[model samples]
Target: MMERRAYPLRISAVVLDAMQRWSEDELRSLNAQIEFVLRDALRRSGRLRPPPADPMDDTDGD
Candidate 1:
């Protein structure tokens, strides 16, 4: 399991409401949804490395 660090975040009311709605729709807790968005943005911007590919992946037409 990954170690999680807690921190304070100051979010606007409108953004928090939107995040809550999104989290409900996705069936994830508010915190999980927030982390999901942050991780996705980081990966897309190349600030974070993608997870290692699965070693047993054999979907390629070999």
Candidate 2:
């Protein structure tokens, strides 16, 4: 499992409320939703590389 680090964030109330609503709609916790959004943005901007596929997760016939 990937390890997580705690970091304090100071976000505007308006944005926080919007993100909370979005998280509820997606059935995800606020922290997960925020990380998902950040990861997506980083990948889209070519600032983050996709994690290597886990060999143990392979299910296709080989």
Q: Which ten residues in a row have the lowest lDDT in candidate 1?
A: 49-58
Tell me model 1's lDDT, rounded to 2 decimals. 0.94
lDDT string for model 1 (1-62, tens) is: 36789999999999999999999999999999999999999989999976778778888968
Report the C-alpha lDDT of model 2 over 25-51, residue by residue, as the tens digit.
999999999999999999999999778
Q: Which regions of candidate 2 fall more than 4 Å away from where they truly are? A: 53-62
Error of 1 at 25 (Å): 0.3
The TM-score between candidate 2 and the true structure equals 0.81
lDDT winner? 2
Clashes per prediction? 0, 0
